[model samples]
Target: MKKIKVGIIFGGKSAEHEVSLQSAKNIVDAIDKDKYEVTLIGIDKQGSWHLNDQSSYLLNAENPKLIQLNKSNDNVAIIPGSENNQMIHASNGTGLDKLDVVFPIVHGTLGEDGSLQGMLRLANIPFVGPSVLSSAICMDKDIAKRLLQSAGIHVAKGLVYTSANKGTISYEKAAAKLGTPMFIKPANQGSSVGVSKVKTKKEFEQALALAFDYDNKVVVEESIIGREIECAVLGNENPKASLPGEILPQTEFYSYESKYIDEKGAELAIPADLPEDTTKQIQQVAIAAFETLQCEGLARVDFFLTEDGKIYVNEVNTLPGFTKISMYPKLWEISGLSYSDLISELLDLAMKRFEKNNRLKNTVWDD
Candidate 1:
């Protein structure tokens, strides 16, 4: 049997670029070499693509302190009008061999905001994670929360402020309506890139400006006093939610630093200490949110478990981290799936989705 060629695209023009690199490193190491031929496609900070020698780049990336993309390599590009989906030598106009599937670990901004997904769709490639519309909706905090609300899912009250519109709503009005101690963040970013917890009105303007620097839109929500619980959901249609995990961040909240930079920044308790019913309830909501947003392959659904036992759908990460200690894979590990097995499963699902899509009849046939 031929080994499937998998292109793992990582790094991007996002604040989560470093996170993406770590994820790609872990994935490249964990994927079974016998079953797949891995291609490490690095997207530099400037949005340039390059075909890196796997051993040179991925191996170097394993060193957390020294992880950085090696610049000197064959620059690549994904030609938009080509018959086969692939990366090509940018200078020579030579096509990189067609890839069986794309495992896009790029976490935020252009990478996860449906722009990359759209390009892949145009090239007719099956990539891991959600569809274009789903990616776009899930990437936008405001849009995802609104959709969750419409689906009868519990979400904190929030307001959307678009810098482009010069929105008329004042910070005082926002505080009055959503209450004090609000969480302000970029509407379309991930990994808590520009997220801030405004403890008082005095900090509102600063947080707003910081969030707007990342994106034109901002999502300000009434802060929920609860434990940070997360559930990992996998599959396309018949999805399964893994055992819930609790993130005890040493910081006031799970900021970007808590997620990646500091080793002791957070504590993760697999199969969180919750009543059996609460656990099941979170799992159900997770699967519901995954399907509700039309997510494919996998997603990490985060929720707030209040003291009163109420659950609020915080946000869904369409492409959660795959680092050694990341919660998404950690939750699944405690649920009986190994890191290697999870990677294989995602690739299989990508191929299956591609085959299924191709099987659909697109044109009218004379009967």
Candidate 2:
């Protein structure tokens, strides 16, 4: 049997660049060798795409802070509209292998904000995760919250601000509306790259400055005092949700360092202890949010479960972290799907969606 050529695209010009490398390494290590042919495509912080050797695509692979993409490889570019789904050498334009599907593990900004997805769509390649519209909607916290709220899903009360009018909303005004102890973060970033928990006016000012440094828009959300629960979702059309998990953050919040750099920053309780009805409710809400956002393939739907049993949808991660310790795959694993099998399922779903999309009429002919 012919092995499927799978391209694992990782490392990007995002704050989560190092985390992407870690996730890519885990995928490359655990992918079933007999079933699929793996190709490593690493993007540097400068946004250059390189065809890296699978054996030596990463440096300091064990250490999150130092892990980086190995740039000692041939640069490549996707050939848009190619019939064979080919990637070409950037300099010489020679043909590379035809990939059956691409699993883009790039986590933030250009990688996750529909830029790469749009490019892949134009290139006529099957890529994992959500569609361009869904990716864009989920990446922007402000837009996602609004959409979710409109659908009758509970979301944190927040105010969105851009560079143009960032000064108009002062910390005092925000406090009056959102109360003390708010969460400030970049509207379009992931992995909590520029997220901050602030209770004082000075911290709020600093947090806004830091968040704006990552993106033009910022979100100040009233912190929900509840257990941080997450549910992993999979499939297309009719998706399934994994047993919910809880995060015990050692810090004030799950900061960038806690999520990636520090190993003991948080304790994950898989299949979080909850009543049977509450668990069922979480699963239902997870799938509802996934479908509500038009997410395909997979996503990690985060929620705040209040002590009184109130649930609030936090955010949706279209491409959640896939590192060995990441909750996305771990949740699925605990729910019966192993890491390698999950990868295969995602690739299959991508191909299925691609075929279904191709069958649709692009240009209608009048009879």
Candidate 3:
């Protein structure tokens, strides 16, 4: 049997650029060599796509370990369409490496916001994670919450505002609408980038300005005080949930630093210490949230269990963090699936989905 050639795509023009690099490294390292031949495709913070070689593009602060793919000879172009269709134009101007699968280990914006998936779909390649629509929907915090709420899932109440609203919403007026100690976040960013814990009118303006740096639309939600829990959901259609994990942030909340930097920042309790009923409920809600956004492949659903024991779905990450320390992978690891095996499963799902998608007819001839 021939080993599948898998393109491990990472890094992008997003606030989570560094985080994406770490994820790509983890996937590249854990991907089973026996079943897959890996090729690295790195997109820089500036959004320039480059084939991996001796380029230090792969090396980053969070991911110091480096492994270079032997593709120093060419710039590859993905040809659009389904049916074993892809033309990797070589840089040496010779030959092509037909990718049997694309494992996009990128997070945020161009990576996880359905843009990359759209390109992959056009290129007609099997890639891990959600479809274009699901990715786009889940990438927006406001949209994801609305969908979850519509699905009968409990979600925190929040208000959406755009930078265009500028002078329209005074800090005092906005705070009156949504109580203080609210979480202000850019709708399109992930890994807690441009996310702020605003407690006062003065803090609200600063937070809004910061969030607008990352996205046009900002979401402000009343902070739910309680344990922060995360559960990883995998598979397509009937997905399974991994054991819940508790996030112990070193700061006010799970900020970017606590998420990626600061070694001793956050504590993750795998198979989080929770009541049996609570665990089951969280798992069910996690799956519901995944399906609510029409997510495929995988997602990590976050929730807040209030002091009163009320569970509120925070948000769902269509392309959640894949770093070794990230809850997505750790939860599965505790759920009897090794990191390598998790990678294998994701690729399997991608291929299976591609085959299923191939069955649909794209165009009809009408004379």
Candidate 4:
């Protein structure tokens, strides 16, 4: 049996660039070699695409601290809507071997935000995760919340503001509406970049300025006092929710420092220490949220469980972290799926969705 050729795309022009590289590394290490042949496509923080050995420059060959695209390597462009979907070499104009599928390990902006998925759709290729619509919808916090709220799910009370509305909406008005100790974050960023806990009028103004650096639209939500819980959902048609996991952050909130920096900044409790009833309710709400978003492939649904037992759906990450220590894989691991097996399942689900989609009629005009 011939192994499928998988183009594992990593790195991107997003705040989560380094984290995406780490995810691509894990996928590279865990994907079954017996079943798949992988190629590395590295995109720089500036969004330049490169192929193969040339990508080594993006990271130190020995130890890499940041994701830097390999400048020495050749360049490849993915031209969708072509008979063959692939990255062609620029040197001799030779087309690289065709790709069976693309595993976009790109996080946040270009990767997770639906731009890459839209290209894949035009190319008529089967890439992993949700479709372009779902990806785009889930990428925007404002739209995601609206859709989830319409579905009757409990969400944090907040307001989405653009940079133009910064001064027009006074800090006093915002604080009055949402209260103090709120969280101000960029609408389109992930990994807690441009996210701040605004405890006072001064902090709110400063946080708004900082968030505007990353995105034009910012979200301000009242900070709910609760335990941070996360659940991983997988599959396309019949998605399954993994056992809940709790995050104990070492800070006042789960900021960037708690997520990546400070070695002892956070702790994870798999199959979270919750009462049976609470656990079941969280699981049920998680599935509801997943279905509400029309998500496929996988997602990590985060929540805030109040002391009185109220659960609030925070946000859904379509492309959650895949680092060996990430919550997505950890939850699956506790649910009886090994890390390697989880990777295989995701790939399988992608292919399954592709096959099912191919059966739908494409042409509508009658001759």
lDDT of each: 0.88, 0.93, 0.83, 0.84
Q: Output the TM-score of candidate 3.
A: 0.93
At residue 5, give the lDDT of candidate 1. Answer: 89
Q: Which pairs of residues clash in candidate 4, taking residues 3 or more apart in a chain or in different chains?
A: 54-73, 57-70, 58-68, 58-69, 58-70
Candidate 4 has an lDDT of 0.84
Instruction: Count residue pairs with overlapping backbones in model 2.
Output: 0
- Positional deviation of residue 351's Cα in model 1 after best superposition, in angstroms: 0.6
lDDT of 3 by residue, 19-112 (tens): 7777887787788888888877877666656677523445334432342222233456666773554755544544357789898878899889
Show pairs that collide, candidate 1. Answer: none
| Every model: Cα RMSD to truth | 1.7, 1.0, 2.8, 1.9
Error of 2 at 136 (Å): 0.2
Candidate number with greatest TM-score: 2
TM-score of each: 0.96, 0.98, 0.93, 0.95
Model 4 segments more than 4 A misplaced: 54-67, 365-367
For model 1, how does the per-residue alpha-carbon lDDT over 59-136 read when each residue is reduced to its tens digit?
Answer: 356565556877646888887757763567888888888988999999899888899999888777779988799899
Question: Candidate 3 at residue 310, lDDT?
Answer: 86
Q: Cα deviation of 309 in candidate 1 (Å)?
A: 1.6
Q: Write the per-residue lDDT of candidate 2 for residues 1-367, one digit (tens) a residue.
A: 9999999999999989999999999999999999999988999999999999977888889888788788965899998899873789988988887898999999999988999999999899999999899999999999999989998899999999999998697999999999989999999999998899999999999999999999999999999999999999999988999999999999888877877778799999998998999999999999989998999999999999998999999999999999877999999999999999999999999999999999998778956
How many pairs of residues collide in model 3?
A: 2
Query: Candidates sorted by TM-score, descending order?
Result: 2, 1, 4, 3
